[model samples]
Every structure is written in C-alpha cells, then in structure tokens.
Target chain A: MASPGPHSRFSARVGGTPASISEAAGQVMAIAEAHGYDKAARFAVRLAVEEALTNALRHGHKGLDPGTPVALDVEMLPDAMRIVVEDQGPGFDPAGVPDPTLDENLNRPCGRGLMLIRAYMTEVRHNQRGNRIEMTYQRPAP
Target chain B: MPSPESRLRVSQDAGVTLVEFVDRNILDEANIQQIGEEISGIIETRPQPRLLISFANVDHLSSAALGTLITINNKVRNKGGQLRLANIDPQIYDVFVITRLNKLFNIHADTSAAMSSFQ
Candidate 1:
C-alpha cells in the first residue's frame, strides 16, 4: 500500500518498553512543533499519541514477551495532523470500557486514557482488529 | 538531567504534604514513576497523609501520570486523608476536566487556597 500523502510523514517502530514508548511520544511532539503547531495543539496531539502507545503496551502486549514492537506513523498535513498507532497483540473492544464520568466509575482509572484521547483529537478510529487506531486533528486556522 | 527527585520538590505545611513538580513541559514515564514512588513515600511516612500536588511548572502529563495520580488519590483516601491539586496550567487543567478528575479531586487556584481547604 502507498503512503498517506505528499505531506511530511514520519514512521517508527517503537519498542514496548516504557522508556522507548515515552521517547516515541517525544519524537512525535517534536515533529508537531516543527510543523508550527502551537503549545496547546502540540500538547493535545502528544497526549493522545502517548495514551495510544501506552494502551498498546499495557493491553495489546499484556501476556506477550517484553520487546514486542509498536508501530507509529504520523502525517502532517497543511491543516491537520494524523497519527496511527499499531500494536501486535490480542485485540479488544474499546467500547466495552466503562464510563469514567459516571459516579460509580469516577474512582476507577481504567478508562481515562481513551477518554482523553477522544476528547483531544478531532477523530479517533480503531481498526476492526482493535490493535490499530488512527487519530486526526485539524489545525486551528491562523 | 535533573533526577526525578530533584525535579519534584516536596514540602510540608499545616499537616499537608505539598509536592511541587518541575517538568520542562511533559511528564513522561520516568517522571511519572518517580512521582508515583514519592507519593507512595508520602503515604507511608506521613502520619495523617494530606497531600496537595502543585503543577505550577508542569506543562503536560501523560495518561500514565494521570493513573499515578489516581492511585495516589486512592491511597490517601484509604488512609482517610485527602489529596488536592493546585496551580495547574490551563491546558493541563483541561486534561483534568476532560477526564472528569477535576470533580473527583479538590482542585484550587494556588497552593495557599488548597492548603486552606484542609482546615
């Protein structure tokens, strides 16, 4: 399959280790910053990316070996940012996550990451396998 | 590179343990783990365990850090104490709001305000 577009694109295979996952987030933020994204915008993208990667490491690679790889692909468009995070692990249903905002679930920590990603990004889509997700954000007009 | 302990400054006032974090911009895994350990230390060592986390210098934090905060909060609650947060950047504050954690914790404008809440 051909790559996303003519715009700037970055791809990496991040190690499943905690430190490497964080490092990948840093690289994604740097790329967003270099593309003229402001602080808040960059932060939103960074948080979403980190959350997605963390989910992959925590859920996708749960019972597997420690060094499984998580794939990251970012495409910077003229007015948007697109990111894809793919993990090689057992896929699960994201919709099954409990509602963290509810009073009963308020104290639980399980669903906050996905909530934040959805709140920050313009669109969040998961593949049928649930091991991959694509998130996009439209840049604020200058 | 400043050690996570150095980057996270802890002080005490009026029975409240105040934690001040200095993250140039983001709180990655290392800082989150360090702060998590520090919070655990506070729970273990402090007699009453009242905590007020200050984010005056932090720009952003990952979800893992948020999980750490939730864990810390639960620990404090288990001890029949409280955990509050103060001086958070507006953008960072939005994260709390989006996650609905702003309602779960006692958040204030500054450290002094948060301190007064403990009384």
Candidate 2:
C-alpha cells in the first residue's frame, strides 16, 4: 500500500470477514488523515468505510469461504473522498433493508448499518452487483 | 452452575485493558464516568501513543459508552496518543457508526492490529 501523502490515496485487499473489516477501517483512517484530511472529515470517512465493509462481510459474503477476500478501493479527491467495497458473496436487494428508526424495528439489535452510512456520508449507492457499496463524502465547504 | 448474572465477568487485561460487561442494557452515565477514569488512568501510566480496547463481551452499549469513547479519544490525542477499539461485535459496531463514533476513534478488528498500531 502506498503511504498517504499531501494528496495521498491507496487501495488494500482484505478478507471478507468481520475481523478483517475492522482492521481495514483503521488502515484507511490513517491514510486519510496522513493525506491532510481534517478530524471531522476523517471521522466521516472512517464511519462510512466501516459500515460498508461490515455489510460486505456479514451480508455480501455471509456463508461463502471464509478465505474470500473483499477489495477496498479508496480515492481522495480535492473536495471529496470515495470508497468502493466489493465482496464475492451472494448479492441482495439494497432496497429491502428496513428503516431502523421505524417504530416496529426501533428496539431491534440489528439493521442500522445503512442508516449510519447515510448519516455520515454525503452520498451512498449500491453497484449493479448489489454486493458492492460506494460511499462518498465531500469536505465541508469553508 | 451459578445464575446467569453470576457467570458474567469483567476482567482487566493489561496488554489491551478491557472492561467486559455481559449485560444487554444500555450503559448509564455513572458507568461511563467510571470507565473513562479507568481508561484515563491507563493512558497516564502507560504513556503510549495508542491503546487498544475490546468490546467482545459487551452485547449492547449505551450513549454513555459513546461519550466515554469520545472523552478517551480526546484525552489520548491531547497526550499525543490514540485509542483504538477491537473485537467490537457487529451490532455494537453499528451503534458506533450510526452515532458517527466509528470515525472518532481508530477501531481495529482484533487486539493484535490495535497493539501493532504503535509500530
């Protein structure tokens, strides 16, 4: 992996396991901050990346070979940063996820990843594979 | 065997000190303060730029835990160190992200990566 510079960007390949996802998140955060992103922006990127990666591990690649790896591609733009998380597991319908805040599901222990991703990032979308999630955050305007 | 509550334990691991709570209820304010103090004390004594925390046994964390994490993160950074979380259950990880805390601290998948942070 290339070290993040003033305009640093890098990509890392990690296994699609819950354990690896968290490790990957830390690596990404370090790179972002090393590239000069402010604290708030760094936090946003980390949260989004973590959530997306978790989804890939738990949902995207749920029962497949534990050895399957997830690909994390990150790019730091001048005004925004983008991350793409791809998994080889069976894809699902993104729209099927329920709103966590809904009265019925409010007390449930799961189903909040999407909400968190939406809250922390400026943009979030699922790719055709349905197993790939793309999240983007634009630095707060000065 | 003993009662379920009796089976629950909270031990302090020196390598990556963690307070494991087995209950599912939300953490209250008082507990947060106590945990923060312990974490602070760890930082004061170790003087390491990074600390690894595990939430493996904690099933649910309250907003109080979130606040404690923020306080710890700030204090660690002020001292030129960092606090990293590890083994956070998927459910708890969701809470961190939803509350936007997953960003505030450096979180790792397990203790090894967090400990390796200083290298």
Clashes per candidate, residues 3 or more apart or on different chains: 0, 2
Question: Cα lDDT of all candidates, in order?
Answer: 0.82, 0.67
Error of 1 at B59 (Å): 0.7
Model 1 pairs in collision: none
User: When only chain A is evaluated, what TM-score does every model earn?
Assistant: 0.92, 0.90
What is candidate 1's CAPRI-style docking category based on DockQ? Answer: medium
CAPRI classification of candidate 2: incorrect
Question: Model 1, B36-93: lDDT tens per residue?
Answer: 8867887987666888999898887877777788889899888888888999988988
Model 1 stretches astray by more than 4 angstroms: A1-7, B1-7
Interface RMSD of 1: 1.6
Residue A7 of model 2 has an lDDT of 52
